[model samples]
Target: MERFFTLLLILVLSCGLAQAQQKHSISGKVTDNTGEALTGANVYINGTTIGTATNAKGEFTLKNITAGNYQICASFSGFKRYRENIELNASIQNLEMSMEESTGTLGEVVVTGTGTPHHLKTAPVPTELLNSQMIESAAAPDFINLMGSVSPSFDFSPNTMGSFMQLNGLGNDFIVILIDGRRVYGDMGGMNDLGRINPNNIERVEVVKGASSALYGSDAIAGVINIITKKSKRSISANHNTQYGTYNTYQSTTNIDFNSKIVSGHTTFSQSKTDGWQNSPYEVDGDELVETDEMTQNAYLRRNVRQDLEFRISDKLSIYGGGSYYMNDNKRALSVKDYGLFFEDFSYNAGAKYLLSKSSNITFDYTSDTYKYYYKYNQTKEGKYEAGDYQLNSDQRRDDYNLRWISKLGKHQTITLGSELVQEFYRSEGRLQHDEESVNTLSFYLQDEISLFDDLMLTAGLRVVKHDNFGTIATPKLSALYQLGHFNLRGTYSRGFKAPTLKEQYYYYEKRGTLYLGNTDLDPQKSNYYSAGVDYNNKWLSTNMSVYQNDVDGLIAYENTELLPGDADNGIKKRRQHFNIEEARTRGFDVMVDVKLPLGFSFGGGYSYVDAMNLTEDIRLDYVARHYGNVRVGYFHHWNNYHLNVQLLGRLQDDKYYHEEPNAKGYDLWKLTTTHQLLHSNKVNLKLTAGIDNVFDYVDDVPYGENRGTINPGRTYFVGVNINFAN
Candidate 1:
C-alpha cells in the first residue's frame, strides 16, 4: 500500500509539470451600480478554487493563468453576483465589473447530487437548498433545529439513546453528513451529534434525497446533507458573534482570517452552554416495558476549535491542511448516581489539488478522526478512580486516503474517477467481548456527464467496493434532465449498499439494564431508489414537486432471542440479539413553492407525505412521522447604510409511529426573528438580531415514559450581536 501511494504521487507531479505552459495574469476592479469602489469584495474564476479579495483600491489580480476561455465571477454580501466570460490569450491590464444590489438565492450554485457543480435549477437530481439568507432569517441555535424548521422532509425527536433523526423515513444509519465534501464521522448510538458543526459559520446547506451511493459511497441510501462553510477572502478579516437566550443558554463564535501572496489561514472557536429544562419527572422501577428518566433533558456544555491553512503553489498546484478539537460534557443531575457523560473528538485532514487546465483537475486527500466516550464521576468513589475521574467506555477511529482525477473528454462530456482506501478501528474497555477490532476496505468509482444539447444532459456512474469481511459489492445510477423555457424535468434511478459495522458484528453491551449481543452472520443491507421531479423557475415565482420510493432488503435490527445451554456466560434473561428483517420500504412525495410579493415581501412553504413500512411484519417503521409541513414569510427593506429584515417560520407534523415504544403526538411550533444592519461598509459591519421561539408557549408535557414530539420548554426570547472588520 505504501509503495502504491508513492508511485501515484510521482505520476501526479509528473503530469502537472509536463502540462506547464505560458502564464498570463488578469487584473480587474469591482464596483457598485453607482460606480463606487466595492472594496473587500471577492473575485475568482468560476468552477475553480483560485480566488482573491479586492484591496482598498477595489483592484484584484490573479496570476499564473494559462491561455484559455474562462468565466470570472465576483461576489459581495449585499450585491448581486457578477459573472462574465473572457478569453485570456494575453495578459489583460484592466477589466471593470459593475454589480447590482439584491439578495436572492434562486441563481445560487449547488453541487451535492453529483460530484460536479451545477446551478440549483439545472441539477439533474431534485435538490433542496438552504442558503445563507434563509439561515440568517431562521436564526436557529444548532444544525438539528435548523433542519427541523427549514426542511419539511426532515424529522427529529429526542431519545434516551440519542436524538432520533430521519430523512423521509430512513434513520441515521442510512444517511451521511459531509462538511465541504468531506465526511465528518460515523454515528454513535444510531444517531449523530450534529452539534459538532458550527451553525454560525455555515454558508449553505444542500440536501439531495434518495440513494447516492454511486457517487458518495456507503451510508447514502437515505440522502446526503452537505454543509458548505464560509470562506473570508481578505488581507485580514475578523468576526465575532454572541447570543443569549432562555434556559440560561449562551453561545459564542469567533473567527479570524488572514491571507498573503501565497498563503491563506482560517481559525474558528465556538462554545455553547445550556441549563436544560424538563416538563415531566418520572422513573421506571422494574418489570416494565417502558424506559423513563428522572429528567426529560440533560444540561450540556460543548466547545470546539478549528484551524485551516492553504498554500497556493503557483496556482497550478495547491495543498491544504486543517485540524479540529471538540469536547462535550453532559450533566445528568440525579440523586442516586452522581455521574455524567463525557465526549472528546480530534480530527485532521490534508489534501492537494493539481489543475490540468481550466476545465479539469486532480485531487489527493487524507483524513483521520478519533472519538472517545467516557463516564465522569462527580464525587469521590472507592474504585480505581477519584472525583472528576474519567472511565473510558468506547473509542473509535477512522482513516481514509483518497485520490481522484477529473478531465474533460471533449466539448460535450466530462469524466471523473477516484479510488479510496479506508481503515476503521474500534476499542472498548468493557462493552465488547473482544478488546479491539478493525476493518479495511478499498473502493473505486467512475462517473460521466454528457451535455447532449444546450438544455439537456445525462449522467451515469458506478462504484465497486471490496470489504475484508463482506467481500465485494457494486452500485450504479443513471439520471437525466431536460429543460424547456422555464420548466425542468428530471429523473433518476440508483442502488445503495451498506456493510455491517464492527459494533453490530462483534460487540456486546448493557443498555437500560439489558444485555445486547452482536451477530457475526448478519447480512449486508441493500436498497433500490427511484425518483422523478419537475421544477419551474422564473423572476417572481419558483415551485418544485418530487416523488421518490426506496426498497431495502436484509435490514438489520435487534430482537429477543433465547439462549442455548452452551451460552452460559451469555445470560438468558433480559437479552437481545441482532437479526435481519428481510424486506422494508419507504415512499414519499414533497411539494414546495416560493413567490415574491409586492412591498418587499416573500412567502414560501413546503409539504411532505411519507409512508414507511416493514413488509415482513406489515407494520410502520419506528419513530417515523407520516406527514409534515412548513411555512416561511419574510420582509426586507434597505435605505442609506442600513438594511432590515423580519422573518417568521412555522412547522407542523403528524403523529409518529413506533412498534415497541409509546407513539409521539404531533405538534406545532413557530418562531419570529428580526435582523438589523446597523452599519454596512467595505471596512467594517455590525448586525443585531432578536427572536422569539415557540411563540404559542407550546410544550410537550407528556410523561417521561412516553415519546414527545419536541422538547421545547415554551416561549423563549433571545438577542444576538455580530461585528465584522476587514481591510
Candidate 2:
C-alpha cells in the first residue's frame, strides 16, 4: 500500500510540473490608448529578473513562469504607467493588455518607413515625425511651403511653376518620396518639386535625413520623405477645412466617411489657388532688373481628390484601396525666358490582405501612376527664335506591385518576407526629349527578430535588389536592444544602395548653348550607416539622444558634355554629364525630450544637428541647414459644455547653402493654435490656428539661376479654421 501511494504521488508531481510549465508562459501584445501597437515596451513581474521587451511587431512572450497570481507592469515612454493583476491558470496561454497615452502627452510615436513603427524613446535612427495637428497649426500655403514652419533642415523656395523644396544640398532627384510605403516619383525638368503634393490629404509626414538606400533603395541618397494618408474610423463622421490668406490664396478641404458591417470608406477633396508673388524686376537684393530680362507675377493653382475604401469579405480577409488625382498649373522664370507649365497626374492603388492563421498574415498591393506635362512659352529676348509660341508635352507612367508575408514562428522568433516589382515608361516631345525607357526592378527582403533572453532582443534583416542597369546588390541590417531597469540602449548598423535614375541615364539637355550627354556607364551609389542611442521613459517623462553616420561611395558628379550643337570646345556653356565621385559622408546627432507635467499640461522639443557635405568639392551641400529644432507647450481642459485647448510653437533653423552657394542665415518662427468644443446634441467642433512665419521678417538673398538672386518672402501671417459634424 505505501509503495502504491509513493507511485501515485510521483505521478501527481509530474503532472503538476507539466501544468506549471504551461501556466508560466504567457504571450501577447500591448497596445496604446489609441489602439495602435506599442513597440519596445517592457513587461515584467515585480521583484523578479523575469521581463521581456516588446518586439518591433509589438509582441512579447514570457517563458518558464511560475504558476501563480502575479502583478504585471507594462511601461513605455510618453505614456502613463500601466500595472495590472493577471491570474495564471493551468490552461492559460496568452494575455493582451492596452496602455493609454499619458494625458497631455505631446510627443507621440513616429513611423519612418522602415517597414515598422517605433517610439522616439527607443528608436535607433534619427527621424522626425509630424502629425496633422502640427501641420494644421502651421497653416502654410501648401505642403512644401509649410516647410518654413515644420522642419528647418529643408529650405523651400516657392516657384510659380511648381512647389519647390530642396532636401539638404542634394537635387530633387536624390530624394526619395513615398506615400504609405509606396514610392511616388513626380518630376518636372529633372526636379520632383514638393509643391506638387497637396497637404490636405496627408495624415502624417515622416522625415529621415542622410542616406537611406538600405531600406528604400535608390533616390534616397539625400533623404527619405514618407507621407501617410488618413483612414476612416467608425467614430469619425465628417470634417471640413478652409483657409483664405494673402496673394489671393484660398484653400478648401473636405472629408466624409461612412461605415457598415461589410463596407467602409472615406472621400476627400481639396482645391487651392494663389496669385503668387512678383517675379519680375527680380535681381540680387531686389535692386534693379537687367535689360533684355523680364519677370512677371505668376499664379499657382491645384485641384486634388482622394478616396479610400475598406471592405471586409470575411473574418480573415479584407481589401483596402485608395486613388488620387492631382492637377497643377504654374510658371517658371529664367533670364530672358518665362514659361507657363502645367502638370496633371492620376494614381490608383489597390491592396488585399488575408489572415492565414492566428499568427500569420499576407498582403498584396498594386499601384499605377501617370504624369502628363505641358509647357507654353515665348522668349523674353529679341531673337529670330524657332518654334515661336511653342507648346511642348510629355508623359511618364509607373506601375508598382508588392507582396508581403508576416509570421510569428513561436515565442522566440518572428519573420517577414516581401517582394516588389516596378516598371517605368517615359515619352516626350521637345528640344530635349527621350524615347520610352523601361526599367525593371525586382527586390526581396527577409527580417527576423530573435529573443535571446529576458532583457535582450536582436533584429536582423537582409534585402537584395536587382536592376537592369546596376545588376544585383545586397543590403543587410542588424540591431540590438538592451533593457536596464528604466533605461534602454540600442545600436544599429546597416548598408544602403541606390541605382541610377532614368534622368541620369538618358536625359539630354543644353545649358547655355552647351550640349550635355548621358552616361550609360555610371555605377550605383552605396553607403553604410551606423547609429547608437539611449532612451529613458517613465510615467512623467521620456527622453532620447542619438548619433549617426553615413559613409557613401560612387557618388555622382556632373562633367561638361563634349558634344554640343555649337561646338566651340571653349568648355563654357556646357551641359552636365554624370560621373562617379570618390567618396562622401554625412554625420548628425538628434536629441528629444518630453515632459508630462501636472494638470493636463505638457512640454516637448527636439534638436537635430547635421553636417552633410561633399568630399570631392570640399563644400557644404545647399539647402541642408546644419541645425533644426521645434518646441511646443500645450494645455487641455475638459468641460461639460465643451472642451478647450491651447498650444504654442517655437521653431528654429540654421543657415544653409543653395546648391553651390555659401549659406543662408538661419531664422526662428513662432505660432499659436486653439480649439473649442460645442453642440451637446450633434457632435460639433471648431479649431483655429494663428501662425507668424519668419517672426522677425528676416529677408534672405536666395540665389537663383546661374548667378542671379532673389529675396524670399518677408514675414507672413496665416489663419485656419476646421469644423467637424456628426450625427
Best by TM-score: 1
Listed per model in order, the count of residue pairs whose N, CA or C atoms clash below 3 Å is 0, 9
Model 1 worst lDDT window (10 residues): 283-292
lDDT of 1 by residue, 347-366 (tens): 99988888877788988888
Q: Relative to the true structure, how large is the alpha-carbon lDDT of every model?
A: 0.83, 0.65
Candidate 1 RMSD to the real structure: 2.7
Query: Model 1, stretches more than 4 Å misplaced?
Result: 10-23, 32-40, 46-49, 56-58, 66-69, 75-81, 100-103, 286-293, 334-336, 563-573
Q: List model 2 lDDT by residue over 1-727, tens digit each.
A: 2244334334422332221234356788888866777765767654333455665456777655666676677767557557777776653445677887653223455656345445544433456667666665456667765555556456554444443455544546667788777777667766564554567657778887655424565446667888876544433467887777656677878888765546777888888887655433444322444433323335667788888887765434667788888887775445445556778888998877665654566777778999887755644435733322545466788887777777878766667788777787767544324465668888888877676787787777788988877788888877777878878887777777877766677767564455666677888889777778787778788777878887778777665545555466664454668887777777787787768788978787778787877788776654567778878787778778676666676777766555744455666666565555443333556766555555565554333332212233556666677787653
